[model samples]
Structures are given as C-alpha cells and as structure tokens.
Target: MTRSLGFGVLLALQFLTRLPVPVQCPWNADTSRWAVRCYPLVGLLLGGILALTGRLLEGWLPTPMLALLLLSLWVALTGGLHLDGLMDVADALGSNASLERRWAIMKDPHVGSFGIIALVFLLVWKGTLLLALLESGVSLAVLVAVLALGRFGAVALLVLSPAARPEGMAWAWKQHLGHRDLLLALWPLPLCFWLLPGGMVLFAALVPFLLLYGLAMIRAFKGINGDIVGAAIEGGELWLLLVAWIWWSSAMG
Candidate 1:
C-alpha cells in the first residue's frame, strides 16, 4: 500500500506538474485512482516552492516584481496546463454556439479572441491579488492552503461530476474514482486547518463556489471535461486568493 501510494504521488507530479519523476508507473485503473487522490499533494508541493520563493525575495525585490515573478513561477511549474484549459473554456463559453459547436471550439488548436482576452484578464487579476497578499504580509500557510484547496476542488469535480465526453484524461481519472476516493482527497484538509488561522472558513467558502461553478459547467456543456476540470483549478485558485486577501486585510486592519 505504501509503495502504491508513493507511485501515485510520483504519477501525479508527473501528470500535473513539470517536476521530474524518473520512474514510469504502469497506468491502470488503480494507479489512475491513486494519481487522482494525490492531486492536492502536487498543489502543496507547488505552494511550497512559491512560498519559499516569496520568502527569499521578500525584502530584496519590489512587491510588484515579486508578485509577477511568483505568478510566472506558478505557471512555469504547471507548464500552463491549467491556463490552456482556462483559455479553451473561455473560448468555448464565449462562442455562445451550440454545445457541439462549443466542444469543437475547445478542440481547435488555435486560440480565439475570447480566449486571449480571458487569459489576459485572469493573469492580471491573479497578479493583482498576489501583489495584495504579499504587500499585506501573507502567511506561508495561507499560500499553501490556497493552492492545495484549489487542486482539491479539481479532485472534487473529477469524482463528483459526470464527464462531458467518454474518452479523455478527465474521464479516465473519473472512471476508477468513487465516493470513497473523496476521503483520500481530504487528507490535506486537516493540515490546512492546522496551518491556517481560519481554515474552516476557507473550506466552507470553497464548497459553495465549487457547487455553483460545477452547476454552471453542467449547464454550459451538459457535463464536465478535462478542460472544465482545469478551469476549475484555475478559478478555484483565484477565488481562494481573493478570500485570503480579504481575510488578511481584515485581520491586519
């Protein structure tokens, strides 16, 4: 069981981030399920790196530059996989076309004007939020929780929602996942609560956002897909950052 869990973490790092995982794990339903459960761990790893970077550069660089650098590192770590999904979903939803047409738009290799605009807006907002959080002296624990919860939201979508298509990465991940898998995904929650001051509030806030976003995706595409799941990760991060900024501001003031 320990070996399987280790392989699962490695597989998740390989699949979700640009991190080097030198071993090849055989892909099967069990391995896939393990990978799904470890998604939040991948997010925690990313958050750790970002938090370390921020701490090291805190006094040396201007807050704006540091925020931009952190944002760039965040994207680099994930190879912009979730950003691509965000852009695709933006293009598809902006088209206001039929469901079939929107799906086709998502598959198109070329990004549309809407996609470009959405990308710009998301980056700008995230960067701004990062700047605010940093300026207010955000805690490393908050940073880690923000990222872990964002990916946890992805796991939630993967397990709870039906896939838009029968064959895709999201569908494959969902295939072997059951309600029991959600308990495994909750592994990071206690750590988050222990680390952050108002962790329960953060978790409470995330649930409604996911529910509304999941429902919206279902309404938009009839079911969720890899793109939808990716979009959720991106959106969840943004929302969590916003919440953290607000919470920190109120506390500091």
Candidate 2:
C-alpha cells in the first residue's frame, strides 16, 4: 500500500502535468526504482492536462498551430524526457545490422539520419492527430482518453516484462512487479470507458496497434538492454498519436 502511494507521488512530481495535489512520496526511499514504476502514470495524469489545455485554447488558434503548441507543451513539461528516448530507439531500429550493432547505436547518444526521420514523423503524427481531434469536435474525450491509455500501456509493459538489466533501476522494479503490480496496472483500464463514449470500440481498435508496437519493440529490446523502457514509453505514445490522428483525420476530411 505504501509503495503504491509512493510510486504515484513520484510520478506526479516528475511528470509535472500540474496535478491538484502534491506528488510527494513517503520519504523517497529507492527513488530510482520508484521512478521507473511511476513513469507510465505520468502519461495518465497528462491526459487531464491535455484536455484542459485543449479546451482552454480551442478556437483561439488554428488547428495546426494549436496541435504544434500542444505537443510543444508536452515536450516542455516532460523536459524533452521521453522524446530523447524516442530518438535513441529510432536510431537503434534505424540500424540494419545485427542486434549487437543496434544496441551499440542506441547507447551512442548521437543522432543519426534514421533518428531524425523517425522523430519528425512521430511528432508530426502526434500533432496532426491533436489538430484533427480538436477539429473533429471530440477533442476533450479523445485527448484525455488516449493520453491515459498510452500511459497505462507503459505500465502494462512494466508488469509484463522482466528487467533486461541485473543491477539497475529496471532490476529494482522487477522485484516489485509481484501481485500488487496488477492492481496498479489494471485500475487504469476502466477509466478509458468513462473518458471515451465510443467505449470498447476505441479499446478494441487499440489492441492490434499495441500488438504490432510490442512486436516492433521486442526486436529493439533484443538488441538493446532494459534501457528500452524509455523507448517503449515513447513508442506507446507515438502509437496512440497515430491511432488518434488516423481516426479524427478521417472524420475531419
């Protein structure tokens, strides 16, 4: 019980989506481990912020500009945190060599041609979806719902995956991913139904997207180590971004 609350607070503080209450844990024990566990919850909280931001700015700017700004907001709020991982992951997968070579590329911390292309396409994909969602008159629900689920998606990975590393934060989380892990992970799923009136239709649609996403990341994980957690988060976000964009984009035009 204490661990869960502590995990939740660490997430709120780090993600800084401006939640109402303080995101403080019970004394910051094992901060790094907690950070990994709470990482996905950040996306869920951002869902509310995303909706509020959208509502506040609706009709105040053009859809494209608003979309761009919305994404910019996330970049600033998270301190360009996951986007960097997205780039690294892209660079890793961007390689056509063996798994060992891809892992080497991911750790370089240098951007390559493939990294640049993937990052741009993902940002555009996310921004375009936001614009389309706002334009489609479903901005509030879709933004909030998708953001929430995307985060949940990350947590799901935590519950399902074993730490690829032996002594790092990911390893620590592996120790904690016992029965209680399911409690934190499953609680967020139902929230989607409330946020999106489309209900299970939206949920059903996300499954295949997630499946393909998981498969793609498996190849990357096989190459790199557990550092791919960061990459997985960004991948989940991008997947949702594309899903939302395609749905609302089709509706708008």
Candidate 3:
C-alpha cells in the first residue's frame, strides 16, 4: 500500500507542480492513466516552485523576465501536459460535430485554431496572475497555498466527475476514486489553506469554485471525453489564477 499511496501523492504532486518527480515507468499502460489523472497537481507544484523561485530571484532580475523564466521551466518540466489538454478541448469545443467526432479530433496530434487561441489566453492569464502576486508582495506562503489549493480544487473534479471515455485512463480510474480516497486525498488541503492567516474565506470559496467547474466539466466530458478532462486541468488552473488575483487585489485595496 505504500507504493499505491506514494503513487497517489506523486500524482497529486504532478498535478500540483511543474517539478519532475521520478516515474518508475512512464507511458506504459499500467501507469499511464494514473499519470494522466494526476497531472493537474503538476501545475500546482509549478505554482509553488515558481512562488519559491520567484522570491529567491526578487530584485535580482527584471520581474517579468524572472517570472517568465520560471514559468517557462514549469511548462517544460511537465511536458506541457495540461496545455495540451486545453488545446484539445478548445479544438473539440469549438467544433460542431457530435461527441464521437470531438473525441476523434482530440486524438489527432495536430493543433487547431481553437487550441492555439486557448493556449495563448491561458498562458497570458497565468503569467499575469504570477506577476501581480509578486508585485503585491504577497507572502511566499500565500503563493504556495494558492498553488496547492488550486490543484486540490482541480482534483475535486475527479471526485465529482464521470469518465468521458471507456478506453482511457480516466475511465479506468473513474471508480478507483471514492469518498475514502477523497478523505485521504484532501488531507493536505487545510494546512495549505491555513498558510495564509485570513485565507480561510478564500479557501471556502474554492468549494463552490470547484463545484461549478467540476459539474460543468462533467457535462463537457459526457460529450467530449479525456481531452476535455485534460482541458479541465487548464481550466482549473485559470480559475485559480483568477481567484488569486481577485484576492490579491482586495488585499491591496
């Protein structure tokens, strides 16, 4: 069970950050689905790593360039996992065909108009939020907490989501996650949330934020499948970015 929990934690970490964690076997069928489902946590880790790294580099370089360098590293580290999802989902969502057509398009390795546009927007938004957080002089702990909680919000989608495809890892792990897993999975969130002194209000807001995103994603998945699930990770990241920005704005006001 140590291996399974470790894998799960890594999966969470993978979804939460951009840092590379060792993979025993990557791209194999046995571990592939676990890897994919756990990807959002990779973004969370990216945020935290960037948060720490950004602080270290503060006053050492141009803030935007510093943020960009760290941000680029994150994209490279996770192999742009969620960005691909965002692209695929954008392509599928913009199409007018039936569910099967959407799924077929998502599987193609080609990029499309919608996907390109989506990537541009999401990256811009994420970068903007990071720069703002830094400019606001937000504590590094708050930055890390935002990163972690954003991911916890993303995974909450899996808890509430239904699998969109029968052949993929998402489907394989659909029933694998349950309330028991949720209780265990969610354990780290509170401490992360508590990292900000009065951050509880913002933390509570993630519940509805998660619910809206999760349920809307389920509807999309029922039509779109795994590509959209990947898309949901980016969507979750975007949501977190927005929330952090709003909170920072309010805090500054």
Candidate 4:
C-alpha cells in the first residue's frame, strides 16, 4: 500500500512539476487515474519550495527583485506548463473565430498576440502581488495556503466537470476521479486552515469564484480539458492571492 502511494506521489510530481521522481511502475489508466488524487500533495510540495525561497531570500535583495526572482523560480519549477495553457486559452478566446477554429488555435504550437499579452499581464500581476504581500508583512504560511488552494481548485474542476475532449490527459485524469478522489484531494484543507490567519474566510471567498470560472469554461469551450484545468490552476492562484492580499492588508492596517 505504501509503495503504491509512493508511486502515485511520483506520478503526481512528474505530471504537475518538473521535479525529478524516478518511477519504473507500469503505466496504465489505473495508475494515471490515481495521480489525480495526489494533486494536492504536489501543490504542498510546490508551496513548501515557494515559502522556503521567499524566506531564505527575504532581506538579501530588494523586494521587487526578490518577487521577480520568486516568480521566475515558480515558473521554472513548473516548466511554465500552466502558463502555456493560460496563454492558449487566451489566444483561443481573443480570436474572433469559430469554436472549431478556437480549438485548433489552442492546439497550435505557436502562440498568438493575445497569448503574449495575457502572459505579460499575468507575470506582471503575480510579481506585483507578491511584492505587496511581502511589503505588508504577510507570513510565508499564507503563500503556502495560496499554492495548495490553487491546486485544490484544479482537483475540484476535475471531479465536477466533464472533459471536452474524448482523448487526452484531462479525460484520463477524469476517469478515476470520483467522490472518493475528491475527499482525498481535500487533505490539504486542514493544513491550510492551520497555515493562514483567516483561512476559512479566504476559502469561502475562493470557492464561488472558482466555481464561476469553471462554469464559464464549460460555456466557452463546451467542456473542460487539460488546458482548462491548467488555466484553472493559474487562475485560482491569482484569485486566492487577491483574497489573501486583501485579508492581510485589512488585518495589518
């Protein structure tokens, strides 16, 4: 049982981040499905890395530079997988084209003008938000909560939404996701409450926005896909960061 859990963790890490986790287990739908349950664990791992990076470099560099560095580290760690999805979605939406055209555009390797603009705005927003949180004396724990919460949002979408594509990573991940998987994905919730000052309040604020975003994706794309899931992770992070920033500002002031 422990060995299986380890394999699931390895699979989750490999899929979610650019982390090295060697695994020789046979690849099958069963194993692929179980990886979804371990999504929050991957988020916890990322949150830990982000928190450590921020803490270790707190006073070593200027806050703005430090924020940029941390943002770069975050992108590097994930290999910009989610960012790519976000850009693709942006490009698809920006194009005044048919649904099929939009889908085709999303699958295209080359990025469009909208994608570039979206990526720029996302990076700027993230860097500025991180700077604000740091200057406001927000604890590293809040960063950890924000990261975990974002991944949980992804898990929620997987469990709740049907896939747009008949084939692809999202369909495979959705196949094994059930109520049981959803319960497992909530493992990080308690830790979040312990980590953040007003965790419950922030969590309440996050759910509605995430649900609305998920619904919008369904309407826009007809259903969810891997790109949509990736977009959720990126979007959820921004939403949670906004809530945390507001909470921190109000609490500190």
| Comparing 3 and 4 on lDDT, the stronger one | 4
Overall lDDT per candidate, in order of appearance = 0.89, 0.63, 0.63, 0.84
Which digits, one per residue and each the tens of the lDDT, describe model 4 over residues 1-253?
A: 5666667778888889998776676456556656777787788779889899899999999998988888999999899999999999999999978889989999999999999998999888888899999999998777778778788888889888889888888887887678788888788678878877688876787789887998888888888889889988988888788888888899889
TM-score of each: 0.97, 0.80, 0.82, 0.96
- What is the alpha-carbon lDDT for the whole of candidate 2? 0.63
Order of quality (lDDT): 1, 4, 3, 2
The residue pairs in collision within model 1 are: none
Q: Looking at model 1, how many pairs of residues clash?
A: 0
- Model 4 TM-score is 0.96
Q: Write the per-residue lDDT of candidate 2 for residues 1-253, one digit (tens) a residue.
A: 5675666556545543434445455434344445544544555567667678878988898888887888888776666666777787778777877877876787797899888997798777777766766766765766566655665555556566555446544455566555465455545556766766663555566567656666666655642234465556566666666666676666667
Query: Candidate order by TM-score, highest to lowest?
Result: 1, 4, 3, 2
RMSD of model 2 against the true structure? 3.7
Task: Give the per-residue lDDT of model 1 (tens digit) for 30-101.
Answer: 778888899888888898899889989888999999999999999999999999999999999999999999
Q: How many residue pairs clash (N, CA or C atoms closer than 3 angstroms) in each of the candidate models, in the order given?
A: 0, 0, 17, 0
Best by TM-score: 1
Worst 10 residues of 3 by lDDT: 25-34
